[model samples]
Target: MKVTLERNHLLKSLSHVHRVVERRNTYPILANVLFKASDDHVELRATDLDIEVTESVPAMVSTPGATTVPAHTLYEIVRKLSDGAEVRLETDGGENMVLTSGRSRFNLACLNPDSFPDLKSGAFAHEFDIAAASLRELIERTQFAISNEETRYYLNGIYFHAVQNSASGSLFRAVATDGHRMARAEIAAPAGAEGMGGIIVPKKTVGEVQKLLDGVDGDVHVEVSDTKIRVTVGPVVLLSKLIEGTFPDYDRVTPKNNDKQMLVDKAGFAIAVDRVSTIASDRGGKAVKLSASNGLLELSVTNPDHGTASEEVAVDFETDGFEIGFNARYLLDIITQIRTESAVFLFNDANSPTLVKEEGSEANALYVLMPMRV
Candidate 1:
């Protein structure tokens, strides 16, 4: 196989697919990337058993063949090559492949391409096209809340499903929770997405999808089945297995009747929480106490080993006075995602979950944060 392509094209394609190959692999071939050159382009594919990422870049193919090479090594070599330089990959059906660029030449060991595994994307029951920006928002807004706990594997990814209502037509929603906090985002359901069953996309696959969606302005095609999901973005394609466990009904835990409403400046509240939590203990959940009454909101943190810190920020709270404690990191995570100038917080009591929403984006993105004892 002999293929020549520009360094930039090869590097970009490699960057998109190489991340799918994990650093530690049980099989040697799994650590390598499969390259197939034919006609006017070369296809690069990498997989880590659970997810597969493939991208094709334009190239000049003198000889059409396929081979596998160390993914990370080739990526690093192409990344260091001079800009606009021509890259040549040649393999003479042997155990080694040669990479040549300007004055740099390196020989890398090649693995049998036939031995590489393929995540057979059989058939999809539901398929739809969604704008890249809308898809990106659905993933980015809720990814932070995905649970890392392995025992309750259902919460490890965002739950995607379509909802139909007479009042609003069809809407697609993404929900993620780690038992302590939950993030939910929704958009108008793209055509062909109605009545689709919920699917739990693994966390790693969600992250990779988000990365590929970056800077993409065109529409992305999504195919979903009972066990797998396939996403096509331009010349790149990704296939991932869906988590088998069922996600809990998050609506039951979502607070609905929280009567007390407090609206605070998003930036100011975030800064105050950050400053006061500085002295909180780092070992456990960094608890920050919020004391809201009248028109003054005081944030404080107390640590027996360290010291104490406090800050006050004015807020709009008309209900009865109350005090609540929450994890500082969780608060900051939700606050950073708010899009409006002021964040609305609905509270029932110090023991109940707090519902947070941005002014105009309340329906599109909502966050539920569980309180912590200070």
Candidate 2:
């Protein structure tokens, strides 16, 4: 296989696809990227069994053929080449592939392309196109809450499904939770997304999709099946397997009747929480205590080994008085996603989950955080 392409173009394609290949692989071929040079483009593909990514870039093919080379090694070689320089890859059906750019040359061992595994997408039951802006919001708001615990594997990805919203037609929702906190975001359902079965997009796949969405505008094509999902963003395509376990009914834990409301400046609240959390003992816990009453909210953290720290911020709290404990790291994660100036917090005493959302905005997104005993 022989192909010539601009260094910038080849580097961009390699960066997009090489991330799918894990650093250490039990199978040697799994650590390599498959390259197929044809007509007017070169197709690069990399997979780690659970996820696959493919991208095609314009190139001049001298001898159309296919081969495999270590993904990271090739990426590093091209990345160091001078920008705007031309990259030439040639393999004469041999064990070594020669990479040439300017005065730099490297011979990389090649693997049999026939041995590479294919992740069959099967037949998709649902396909849709969603605006890039809407998709970005759904992912950025909820991805932080995806659980990393492997035992409850269903919570490892964002749950996506469509539901009827009589007032606004149909809405597509993305939800993620790690038992202690939950985040949910919704957007108007795109055409063909209605009636689709809920799918759990794995965390790694969500991250890769987010990266691919960068600088991308317009709409992204999405295909979903019972067991797999395919997302096409520009010249890149990402296919991933869906988690098999069922996600818990999130509505049950979403508080709807919290009577007390507190409105605080988002920036002030986040800063105060972070400052007080600095004193929290790393070995003990990262809990911050919130005491609200009489139009003021006091944040404090106590550590037996390091004493205590406290700060106060004015808020619009009508509640008589209440104190609650929450993980400072979790609170900051939710706060970062709030796009409004004010953050609205609804409380039902100090023991129940607290509901959080942007003040004076339509509820397109919401967060729930369970309280901890300080």
Candidate 3:
């Protein structure tokens, strides 16, 4: 393969697919990216058995062929080269790949394209269009709450499902939970994505999709079967295997009616929780106490080994006094996502789940944080 691509153009496109390259590989080909040149486009692909990412960028193709080049090596070379320096890449006799820019030259070991594992692209049972921005928003708002514990493999991914909102018809939603905290975000279902089943997309796949969605515009062709799922966003396609386990009954866990409510500034709330956590014990969890009543909101943390910290912030509240304890990190995870003037919190009592919502985007996004026993 012989192609000349602009440095920035090549980097941006390669960045989308390179994440699939295994950091530690048993096979050399698995560590390389499959580079194919045809017509006026250069395609790059990498996989780690479970996930595959492919991307294409416009380039000047002189000879149409394909080869596998060390992914990280090529990326490092291009990244170190001077900006805007056009990069020329070619393979000689399928033995090695050569990269040249100005006076710099680097020869990288290459493997024939036939040695690369199979990567498939096909018709999706449900092909739909979603604004790159919209999908990114949905993923970002809920991904943090996904469970990282491997023992409970089922909670390791966000659950994508079709949900009906009493206020606004049917919506496509992404929900995640770590048993203690939960996050949910919804968007209007696109025209073609109807009657789709809930699928659990592993965390790695979510990160890959988020990386590629930057500044991208267009519809992603999304298809899901019982075993595998594929998303083609523009010139990039990400294929991943679905988690086989079933997600928990999330609906039952959602609090029904928590009459006590408090609306506080999001930034102030996060900052207060952060400061109070500093004095709390570093082990177990960073627990903080929240006291809400009248128009006052107080945050306090006491460390048996260290000292105590507390802060008071003005908030809109009208209910019986409530003191609740929660992990500071979990609070920050859900609070940082609130992009509103005031973050709304509803509670039942000390040992109940607290519902958090943003004033303008309350229904669009919601969080359930189970309080810690103090």
What's the number of clashes in each of the models? 0, 0, 0
In candidate 2, stretches whose alpha carbon ends up further than 4 angstroms from where it belongs are none
- How high is the CA lDDT of each candidate model? 0.94, 0.94, 0.86
Error of 2 at 243 (Å): 0.7
- Name the regions of candidate 3 deviating beyond 4 angstroms: 121-123, 360-362
By descending TM-score, how would the candidates be arranged?
2, 1, 3
Q: What is the lDDT of candidate 1?
A: 0.94
Q: Each prediction's TM-score against the native?
A: 0.98, 0.99, 0.94
Task: Compose the digit string of candidate 2's lDDT tens values, residues 16-105.
Answer: 999989999999999999999999999999999999999999999999999999999999999999989999999999899999988999
How accurate locally is residue 106 in candidate 2, as Cα lDDT from 0 to 100?
96
Q: Judge candidate 2 against the unseen true structure and give its global Cα lDDT, from 0 to 1.
A: 0.94
lDDT, residue 119, model 2: 98
Q: Candidates ranked by lDDT, best first?
A: 1, 2, 3
Q: What ranges in model 1 sit over 4 Å off?
A: none
